[model samples]
Target: MTGRHAQHGLTLLELLVAFAIMAMSVGMIYRIMGGNARNAGELETRQRAVVLAQSLLALRDTVPEGGLQLSGESGGYRWSIHSALYDTGVAGPSVTPLHELAIVIAWDDGGRRRSLELTTLRPQRKPSPQVRK
Candidate 1:
């Protein structure tokens, strides 16, 4: 019996094509996962910023008069709070003082700047006038 063994196997070109397809699929999956991770991180940062803003607003009295610019880092994020007098209103002179509070929370995301701002109006007690002779 003359040897006539038939070889059944994928050609080199076929194998190359299969590898290319697999590489493309892997690349796509990697990109999708990366995007998901980024979105999750951004969401987390936003939540943290909200909580920080609330706490800051609650403690707004700590800020000195004429407003202030405070900045710091916490939980892998950078934050800033800016307080200024938005308006004294047109109510003329009044015993009770009103202030505009603005809190700005900021952070970095993949070289992009992200921030959240919270603002409100707060009433403050007028300082007691010094007694004169």
Candidate 2:
């Protein structure tokens, strides 16, 4: 072609390469967005588990001095609470008896088992003295 009639457009090969690059870029972006969405869901589930476990632990005062074991399900999640005497390793009678309270939250996520556990120490309440007649 003469210089005066020179083409001002991309060749077929260039267009094909550009389209390929664009396709790959779009695929990568789609994958990133999908992964972000999945992570957000997993995080939400974990946050809910933590909140449930905290709520169960808040009932520590009601636990018996001999310790209590309970389990139940709520909102598609299975939960359990286990309480036992917490030995501080201090010899002799302590001023306040401590108990270890633990809560486990479990659920099914995308065919996988997910669980969270939280533990705390609480003092046992003493029994009231008998009233004199």
Candidate 3:
């Protein structure tokens, strides 16, 4: 038993190495977590933009014959709605005209311009004929 002594604990060099490795691992974990948090925030912003776009599209039935062209800002986002006549290449007196409606939502994210567009087709409304008094 007196021939050799057992090593009871790590040396100073070994302890330093272990600390360095732990620091590196913690740094990597923090970086990953930060990225995930940023992604979640961006997703939330995009979802809000989609909701706003949908609400704007729901007003399609109220569009006038001359076509709707409106723009405004809401919740730090700028939005625009446009309508145009969509040609089906078919000509007839009884054919109902189709209108192409588009809504665009734009915002500035981290100094970058981001935008989303939603488009839909709707039938144009015709006025009713008046009867003689």
Candidate 4:
């Protein structure tokens, strides 16, 4: 044969273009992954709020009537609960019965303040009838 056949390999220009495209694709994938990670973190933070709220509610249900305060932290999230005696319409000179309890959970969401509040009624005890003259 007068001339030899060219080798069946990619040209330099083709290789360069392929590399550029791959780089672009990798960058896009990394950006997407980062966004997803941020979203998952936010979801976890919200779930912590839910947990804190529920736990406070449970304590309010079980613990004796008094002031309540709790705080905790987890995975870039922090929470707190506050409880106090609330007016319940039933009032006496000495034995005023508080009726409602309030719980507030707070956290930081990307530098923004996020919070949830839950209010519950305390278990009521039957008031003994007063003797009349």
Candidate 5:
């Protein structure tokens, strides 16, 4: 081979190494993009779960305080509401009324069930007075 031609072109070994490096770089880029897309989807699911939990919890005021369990679905999520009278471990005062409310939101993620829960205590509503004729 001519000296000029040999010097002007990359050696076979060097070209192979260059191609290997480029392949590795492309693989890394593809993996990073795939991971980013998966993370975005997971984040979206988590955020929507939080919203569903919040909405279910907000219904505490309207829920029957005698202990109720309700189930429903919305926004690609399923939710359940559970309520029970909160006990302080002591005898009730008979006047103070309180309820413990729990809201659970669940969804299907990659064939797995993902869920979030929100819980709080709320005061019991007063009964309406009787009307006279």
Candidate 6:
């Protein structure tokens, strides 16, 4: 080789291998980011459900004896609350004096249906303080 001769920077095969590695790295990063985003969305839905459940529980005294249904929208999410009687005890088929409340929060994310639910037991009659007889 002469002293002034030029040198090739990179062979075609080497260049192709480098491009493939870069592409794979980018794809992996994208997948991780996408999964993280999905998880974050799910957490938000769950938190909203918890808040709704707490609010409904706070209003337990307002719930009727038989059944209750509430539907509304908040923070770009639609929610529903269903209250009904639940019996687990087996004693002459008797119902408990408390009510079971279920709150569900739903939202559309990336053309997918996402939802969260929270269930709780609430007293039918709120306790009142009274002086002893």
Per-residue lDDT of candidate 6, residues 53-132 (tens digit): 57766766545665778888887778788987766564442434657888887888778887878788764553456979
Order the candidate numbers by TM-score, best to worst: 2, 3, 5, 6, 1, 4
Off by over 4 Å in 3: none
lDDT of 5 by residue, 12-122 (tens): 999999999999999999999999999999999999899778766765664454677889999889988888898766565575577888888899999999998888887
lDDT of each: 0.76, 0.87, 0.90, 0.70, 0.83, 0.75
Summed backbone clashes in each candidate are: 0, 0, 0, 0, 0, 0
Show the colliding residue pairs in model 1.
none
Any runs in candidate 6 off by more than 4 Å, and if so which? 1-15, 61-63, 88-96, 126-133
Candidate 6: count of backbone clashes, pairs at least 3 residues apart or interchain: 0
Q: Per-residue lDDT for 44-130 in model 4, tens only?
A: 877787786676567555434555566677555455655566766667767545556566677777679987777776653445689
TM for every model, in the order presented, reads: 0.56, 0.86, 0.82, 0.52, 0.75, 0.59
Model 3 pairs whose backbones collide: none
Collision pairs in model 6: none
Candidate 1, 26: how far from true, in Å? 12
Reference-based lDDT, residue 16, model 5: 98
Candidate 1 deviant stretches above 4 angstroms: 1-37, 61-65, 86-95, 128-133
What's the lDDT of the predicted structure labeled candidate 5? 0.83
Worst lDDT run of 10 residues, candidate 4, spans 59-68
Greater TM-score among 2 and 4 belongs to: 2
* Model 2 misplaced regions, further than 4 Å: 1-7, 91-94
By summed lDDT, the worst window of 10 consecutive residues in model 2 runs over 88-97
Better of 3 and 6 by TM-score: 3
Q: Distance (Å) between predicted and true CA of 95, model 1? A: 4.4
